[model samples]
Target: MNDTAHALGASRTLWELAERRAALTPDRPVLLQGDRSLSFGELRERAERVAAGLYGMGVRPGTVVAWQLPTRIETALLSFALVRLGAVQSPVIPFYRDHEVGFALRESRAEFFAVPGTWRGFDFAAMARRLGAKGVFEAYDGEGLPDGDPAVLPPPPAEGTSVRWIYWTSGTTSDPKGVLHTDRSLIAGGSCLAHALHLSPDDVGSIAFPYAHIGGPDYTVMLLLYGFPAVMFEQFALPDALEEYRRHGVTVAGGSTAFYSMFLAEQRRRPGGKLIPTLRLLAGGGAPKPPELYHSVVREMGVQLTHGYGMTEVPMITMGSPDDSAENLASTEGRPPEGMEIRIVDGEVRLRGEAVCQGYLDPAQTEEAFDENGFLVTGDLGRLTADGHLVLTGRLKDVIIRKGENISAKEIEDLLHRHPAVQDVAVIGLPDEERGERVCAVAEQAPGTAALTLAAVTAYLRAEGLSVHKLPEQLEVVDALPRNDTLRKVLKYKLRERYSGTVK
Candidate 1:
């Protein structure tokens, strides 16, 4: 990393980092997808123009703007424009539909909503209108963004302490919590990722996940800090995206354990040759990486597999370094960065640092989310090794993370309870080869009710406005649900153990 790169953490806001990087190498490639490559210079200039456009559309500093778009240059540009204008941004994953989208707009009280207008066969604008989203506008196409002159734009934010990001965390509860993040927090999180990965200006990266994800800014900040380019995959799938990765000579890739497995599967199909010859490391986090999966990635793909542990609240808590021992990398979630303080309180991980979010948007949730010591309760079960490595054993929260997306068990359970065939239901995450965890719905059926099929349950969930990713892959009907002797709360661990050996 260069001197300016090292100073990114000290920078007040994201716009400052963008300016610093552009000053260092204006013409250098920063974001690439297909034939389009956005340079640092273009990123700055175009974002300012977009900012002006937004200003013309009535966007101003501290305006709450919600955007739901795919991984594209326009999305990043619009995001940076919001940063330049010091507007609070709430990025909704493109895959989210009316249920999640509606909840976000109403909760955040977003002044404006940006949608991709019928992207991938879904009518986002229509959905936005149905949800009564205010100031709804298309942002996918170049023509959709509001237009104005840069001279009309206000001065960029000088501080990063105020909350400028509202990231949704699908927790154990039915409703998703809005995680509050500042520019400094995001920069700190990104710095941890960039420095730990030891990425150089020459290393080419890829964003297989949605740019709206918390990892988007986490990874984008790395590109700005190190002055490297990353290929953006609007829609990522093996063999389909492999050509682009090979064409770009992507050196670093991987989104989560599922991503590593996908690459390994692709490698196994062609055993003799390298999948991507330029590939050197596969690093990611968001879900628990199986020990066997890591071994397979390293052995089969011939690339180092390093995983970490993080949530929406704290984007990058620990990251695996290229210099770490293979055993350590495979077993542990690596170590926390310099300023990150990770404390294991009664086996649950607690964190305190600049990278951690300010708290949830709900004051009650915020107060309950952190301990009196000011440490954010991660609700994840972990322990620190003698070598300072983080060993994540399990989670205290009843949330299922499949393919890097957090699915609330309680959310599905609450909705499933309304089903006519079910009396009681417990949603559990079962191990799967493709998705890290396949959502399994175990239900105690009503007496005399017919057996429920997986398809029927998923269709029912779809009708209930659940996201496709959160649909239950496996359905197991039981006569009764196991509950403890105390208050009769269903024990999910028992269900996981019982269903581990079975398939859908």
Candidate 2:
């Protein structure tokens, strides 16, 4: 990172950092969406107005506000507005329905909730009302967002150590855990990413994932630090979304391993033609990346692909730098940034850093999440190379990562056990070339019950209020699930080994 960016990164709060960046490059565009663009100056000024408006709506400093909006310029505006107000903001993914959404609102004790009204044909406002969410309001566009005079707003948050953000992660639990984070932690996480990628002011980036995700603040911090603009894709789909990428000259893109696979598939369709003429690098994290996929992307897509290690608890633990050797870049998850301590204890990855989150909403879970040494005990099993690169071998937790999102196997298993056709159930993640890992349910039929098909299993889970993204994509009926001799626990590894090859 350059001296200027490193100095700008020292700002105490996210709002302070935005103010500093806006002062430096007020006219430069910070966010691009289709034909629209938001300048750095406008981001600061308009967000203050929105903050004042939120003040008029009874939102005060320390007030808990939750928003479930898509990836759009307006979403960023509203988020920053909350930052300006020093409100404790909880972001719920738009893909989550009543189950996850309700859990977040209730756990966070959100005083105000912002929905997209009817987004992507789903009635979010109606659902919020149905869930009895407090202070429900619609804020999909700039016009819909609250606006008032900045004079009414109090001073922006001066401290970044206070927990101001609550991010949801399934982790190894059946229900989502609210991960606590502060502005300083998020800024530190983004700094690790921005510095590792070595982005320049000229580099155009794109966000193809949900803005409600922890990656939202992670990416926005990078933009603020580097003074670059990233295209905001409300709905990212190949072929259809290619035009905007080309229009904005997106130089850096890729949300996860799935995104790389999707781009590779598009490039394969055209053989020698470039997928995006200006594209240069594809970087992301959250899910496993196959070594072969890395080689394929560099050889076929004509771009540098760098994967990293991150989660809601620690947004950027390790990130592959563009300057690293191709071999290291392909095989390892890259090295941790300064101040991020990666310790391998009992073959599991434990992290302690400024970027690491404070803890979870549940006090007991928080107490159990960390070790005596104060390191966050990540359930991921990994090793450190002699050169400091991280090589993740497997996860100790029974969680399935599909397209960068964590899906709890036990959550699905518990729900599936309720099905009349399921006698025993074990949910495992199978290797998928496109999705990094695909959710597969291995089940045994109940006595005097019919066989369960994949379609039937998905429908049953969906009806049970499980998020669409968490539904199993494959199903296999067996006479019995493999169990260990000692505890009679279901051996999920055996199921994974048996079905790993079924996908690819």
Tell me how candidate 2 scores on lDDT: 0.89
Estimate candidate 2's RMSD in Å: 11.1
Which residue pairs in candidate 2 collide?
none
Candidate 1 weakest lDDT stretch, 10 residues: 482-491
Q: What does candidate 2's lDDT look like per residue over 29-86, in tens digits?
A: 9999977999999999999999999999999999999999999998999999999999
Candidate 2 steric clashes: 0
TM-score of 2: 0.81
Q: Model 2, residue 199: displacement in angstroms? A: 0.7
TM-score of each: 0.81, 0.81
